[model samples]
Target: MIPKINGLGRSFAGVAAYCLHDAPTPDERSPETSERVAWTDTRNLATIRAERAARLMAATAKAAPDLKRLAGGSRGGRKLAKPVLHYSLSWARDETPDRREMSRAVDGSLEALGLDGHEALVVAHEDTRHPHVHVVANRVDPETGKAATLGNSKLRLSRWAEGYEREQGRIRCEERVKNNERRRAGQELVRTPWERPRHWARVRRERMVPGRARRARGPRDEERVDMEAWRRVEAEAWETVADGRWRSLRHLETRAREEWVELHRRQEEMRQRLDRESRTVLGRLRIWRTERSLRELAGAIRGRQDLVEGWREDLDGYHRDERAELGKAHGERAREIERGWHKFYRSRLVEAERRAWAVRETMKERQETRERERGPSIIIPIPRPRQPRGPERGGGGFER
Candidate 1:
């Protein structure tokens, strides 16, 4: 099935245009485009120029979005512009025309075209080609957004085509050719290329033509002449039809080639798209990684700051404790010095009193000895007590 691309994004605007019933992702590039739009029946051998292809695709997209599905295959719910489907059929290679061979070719082409639906409607009838059939279907769908649909179906188109050929001087050879015919006598037979391939031109031919008479009369002079004339007309018509058929086949071959080119273009685009998307994702990832790394670095820095702040606070506390202990020790040393001074002063005062008492006792003893000899009232002239000496400067005995 043709992979869908609904609305164009990126470089996809007109690239997804045409889709054959057997077409792969009509909107996408074919294997021929990039070794990726697979060719089912025939290998896509050539490529169309990029510019031309883009233009044709643009036209197709504009004409119809669901062109591929409208042609036949069921494409679910995706609303797309119908793509224009143009095709013509010819022999595979070195093949020619015969009734049986022609029928088989036509049948094969129909199958190859892959008519899952569509191809049923026809307004006229045509018949042509003795051993081959030529089909022309305009890819335009009116009822839907798809290209033209063939509404009348196979049996209907085939019969109509036979009638169409008869009108064009090319006779219908199919067994069931009357169904789509205008049967009324007054009604004129319409020769349309939709059913049969024919060349329309004004030419004078004898009544003895193949189409002029369906059955031949008995063997007689008049019958013989008419038969001969009829044979001649049939020959001429075949030549004209053959020429026309050849041209049409060539045209179809060209269209097929164009389609191959279109497929190739899309394939290349697909590869590019995939590459582009991958690169975009990588770029975004790189940016995200860089940003994440920056964020982590910032967080680590903030944590370190907190640790330093705590250390600073601890150091201040330690200094304050040291100062308090040192101050206490200093006060204790001052008190000990005061105590030592007070003790030294008290000892000096006590020593002075003891010396004074000893002096008194010595004096009393002398007086007692004197009394034993004489009266105890001996006048002892103990010089008055000298004053305690202190630090003095030198001074002469005489008043100077």
Candidate 2:
């Protein structure tokens, strides 16, 4: 179960109206889901709304008028008096607790959080996939005439969820995901046989192609075939050429045609090589680099581990020799270097991975463009050669 606490609200009237909204149907007064006012015996929505509104008004009249002013002067905006708190206590669909149990949980949570004295509404909502309750509480205590502070409400809610899970003996969706993450993190980080070490193994071929040309009204921006950059340049070129004022199409067309031909030639060559069971130059280079990087990372990790183990042995010996502080300092230094090296390697790998992704994207776009160029088949019907009416056989007469 997870509790979603939506910080705070200023208007008590708005909070009351939200809580009093008809369940199942907003217009109907049918109370299909259970609802009740906490800290009071009121179960009716209208009565709860009226009672809460009146309590808010009375509290405001008696309480500190400078509360809003003190919490940052009003300035240009409307004075904020966020004394209403909204909370949604949700349970997983699989673990549907009964009305009594739900109420007990809510009561316990509110009391535990020190908001039991505040005026509040607890309405069970059956509309969502998961069973949950909407809590609208007046942060301004009617009896004390002071707003209730929700310090570390998130921490408190997490504690409540854990306790609830223990009591109910059911694991929540969040808990399951957390467990999976922990298990995954603890396991060895080895790539599968089919998985490539470098992220850009998929897109290495396309990034090699040069970008399209545009008319030069001024110095050209260094053209990039990067997806978004290519698109922007394409659009700008189109707009510039389409405008009647600039009448220079020859250079643009010639440059674009040459580039297109080169790109097509490269793609064709790649296809021919694949047919003959040969890898392209770029493909071979990428594979080699991927293998080298993986090997280096593995060696680095192993070396670090071995270094730490050796340091542990030395530390034990030093402690035996009564030079414990010196051993501790050396051990700390070794661990620091290990952490720093790992951090550096992690950053380098991350940068390489991002570049690989860019290459992959470029290749994907090129593949799509190629597919579009190879449009649907054209079927032309050929007229069959006239069979010699070998003598008007139908009429039983020979044709001249």
Candidate 3:
């Protein structure tokens, strides 16, 4: 359990009203648990608002008249003593503390802080995922006429939590708490505990607004950048420039033209093979009259050899013709591919430069702004007065 302590409520009446009053919208199924409330008999916001504040003031006066004296003037040790002490005791979501155990723990914790004699109200709120109780106590002791210093109160509460856990068989010890704290501080040897789901949601919310909320890790003004990822992108861009891949618009265009020529060479090779096969098929059709005749023994002997010879000759001629035809066709295709690749490569390279330039400019502006905020440097010019020239006098100063 973690205890959050605060000095709240400028006046006794203000504190009393806050403690007794129910939330504006009450939960019928899971109502708040209230205890030790003197002024307001019932947990109703309307009833508390109508007549509780004045009654609470009277109650406080009867309990601690010295506190009233302290409030009327600045005679108390504090320049302005806080009239009420407000705090909350919250447990992990898995721990379901019963009413009796919670009350005992709350009483023990309050006594440990030296507020046992004062009037207090403990209200358990069931709305949150984690079960917690809020304790509001009058800081002033009627007999002593002074408020107790709540220094190192968290340590006291921690001891109380450990005792409560042992007596109730909760098994959470001081050692475990210390280990958890060490793990949260980034100790490698200690294993981090799995946090409740609500913790992650709270973290995400804090990052979105940033600096608006307090976190256990301390203050963060903004989201931290992944410097490694940033450096990777920067290095890649510079490497491309250094390798002469995208040094200039003309250089990128030249690389694109090279790729286009290679693509055309592959297409021409495929076209030559396809044209030769078509010519061989046409030549075979003229020599072979019918499938039945080719299958006949004498017909096959007379025509098969002639058919094979004719097709071979025709395929060789087609290969030569296709080589000439493809040379012309590839020239046009290469130009088209070159134009498309040039436009694409140029746009991409320009985008990369713009992104890198933007990052550099942002960093420069931040540095300059920091220098401006630090104010100008002071350069002190020490005066070195020249020595006065005088007529030499052995025993008396010269008059000029």
Model 3 segments beyond 4 Å from truth? Answer: 11-79, 92-96, 173-176, 179-400
Encode model 1's per-residue lDDT on 254-307: one tens digit a residue: 453354445445545644543443345453344335446554343334444443
Clash pairs (backbone) in predicted model 2: 203-360
- Candidate 2 stretches greater than 4 Å from native: 22-80, 174-400
Q: Give the Cα-based TM-score of candidate 2 against the true structure.
A: 0.36
Q: On a 0 to 100 scale, what is the lDDT of residue 344 in model 1?
A: 42
Instruction: Please report how far candidate 2 places residue 327 from its true position, in Å.
Output: 37
TM-score of each: 0.19, 0.36, 0.35
State how far residue 180 of model 3 sits from its true place (Å): 11
lDDT of 2 by residue, 199-265 (tens): 2311232121112222222112323224444444445444543342122222333343354445445
Q: Report clashes for each candidate as comma-separated counts.
A: 42, 1, 0
Clashing pairs in 3: none
Winning model by TM-score: 2
Cα shift from native, residue 400, model 2 (Å): 73
Error of 2 at 388 (Å): 65
Work out candidate 1's RMSD over C-alphas.
57.5
Ordered from best to worst TM-score, the candidate numbers read 2, 3, 1
